[model samples]
Target: MTTSIRGTANADVLTRFRRSAHWKPLEYAFWCLPVLAYFAFPGNYLLLSQIAITGLFALSLDLIFGYAGVISLGHAAFFGVGAYTVGLMGSHGWSDPLLGLLLAALFAGIVGFLSSFLLLRGSDLSRLMVTLGVALMFFELANKLTRITGGVDGLPGITIGPILGVFDFDMFGRTGYIYSVVVLFVLFWLARRLVRSPFGQSLRGIRMNALRMPALGVPVNRRLVKIYTIGAAYAGAAGALLAQTNQFVSLDVLSFQRSADLLLILILGGAGHLYGGLIGAVVFVVLHDQLSDLNPQYWQFWLGLILVLLVLFARGGILGTAQQWIESRRQRTQARQRAGSTS
Candidate 1:
């Protein structure tokens, strides 16, 4: 009886997972917007590329905070590690973009894996402090290592060769934009698959109730560490993309502000959902661009006001609030149809 029950439960989980993973028409339309942007905004590829990179970074944070219920104030540590990885590699005549990105992800993953153990030891506050401390340490280390990192002056001479030896990164950012979009798509696809699987369901459970997960045979700490490490890799890849596309590296990559901005992006887009980060990135970047052009000094003030309004009125950021509204409308429509049929 126990074996049969367990088998049935597993089958049910698989069924739900598969159903969620099935792509919806809206998702297809969402992806088409990026391709459309290529023609719609021919001269804005540079900004678009930055948006893509920021989106990926937000996605990484979502993996940890949104999915795993982890709080990090220093996630930029991995980003810096990845940026420096690409910078160091390029400065040393290994300008292969792909290899640099790969190394960045690997090194960042290692750092994340090591630090995740510490994260498992603390409460949310402690975890936040630990993450912040780690980032500060990296920031100070980079500042001290002026010879390798160029410190406050920034890492120079980062020459990224043509991607795949064919697409040269042009000043117009045509190639860089495409490359970033491709990487974002591939990673997003993998993440979608991951979060729709049984593993992802367990994560949601753990997030809601960690102690209960352990009772259910889930190794809570191990799972957290794995997701944290993967999130680090994703951040590293984002950093690598920034470094490669911009052909420069700077201490700013490791700044607390970077992580804070990332958190803001996630909040604005709504966490826990995959599309939230991407959508948030687009809105944030465009807002920044337009606002800065309109009022460079007071843009932040306006941005804060907008955020406050959203938090008060939108409930679950943009996407989350939209989903809620859509769900409510659908329920109302269904009720109306059912009532009409009965009458």
Candidate 2:
């Protein structure tokens, strides 16, 4: 009974919040909650930084898969290329964060350009296989060239040489977190605009029905190629973000498992929604952190269990579930008020 009362009270508060003039600011505040949490918990700041990068990468995938109807199993190919570009730059003598980002995007774009021919033709299944093959081939090549790629031992000895040669990536993760947040915010702004643009609409139309898009003169394959290139560049930028913050590059960045995990995050959060990637990343990281702290051996099993529950009950994730509950309550309340007035 107490639990039910509290639930009702929470729902009432949410309804009021939705109606309040302060609600708009509060909505923005909600977006910054992760940033606030990072400051609140310094011990977990590093993990948060990583989660943000991964989320951006996943967001790139959502843009393609959910919005553009592109299926890929080798998205990590661009990510790896981005990471390596940064690694290679840092190890040489370059250290400007902004410049490094551009190089990362540029390199990733090149990779996308090269692979788009293979990706542009093929069913979802074929695209998946081809993309997967590309990533795997890249990983293998990196491993084979151990002297340059660092092989299985991974790339180390990378240093960003300080931001603008003044501020360093705070050994405490403060600089890293702030840097990542800034980059993510910029990318997200660009993504927001991209999604609302005419180009974005075309991609959605293509996703809905490639046949219809072309009949309407959308040049379906060309649009797909272009959007896929953009998405790849975004993924690469995400990888570069990680590399800059960590000052290290590893094979794990290119692993099929990493690509698969990003896909899972997208699914867990609901692909078409914007917040899905960010929310999913937070949940995945927090749960992984907590479970690892408790028992690393069984963390995967526990996460698997959570996925099962999410699949069975929460189709839209926590945010989606909350929204549904709130809407349902509003509907019920309005019905009750109408019936009472009639009586």
**Which one is best on TM-score?**
1
What stretches of model 2 exceed 4 Å from their correct place?
1-27, 319-343
Writing each residue's lDDT as its tens digit, candidate 2 over 1-343 gives: 9999999998986675445323256458866777787768887668878888988898888888878988888899999999999998888888787789899999898888779888777888999999999999999999999999898988888878677678788777778877887787788777766766667778889988988777788998888888888888999999998999999999988999989888888878777665677778878877878898898788899998998799679876766776789999999999999999999
What is the alpha-carbon lDDT for the whole of candidate 1? 0.94
Give the per-residue lDDT digits (tens) of candidate 1, residues 56-135. 99999999999989989999999999999999999999999999999999999999999999999989999999999999
Top model by lDDT, which number?
1
Which pairs clash in the backbone of model 2? none
| TM-score (all chains, Cα) for each model | 0.97, 0.87
lDDT of 2: 0.83
Candidate 1 differs from the real structure by a C-alpha RMSD in angstroms, to one decimal, of 1.4
Backbone clashes per model, in order? 0, 0
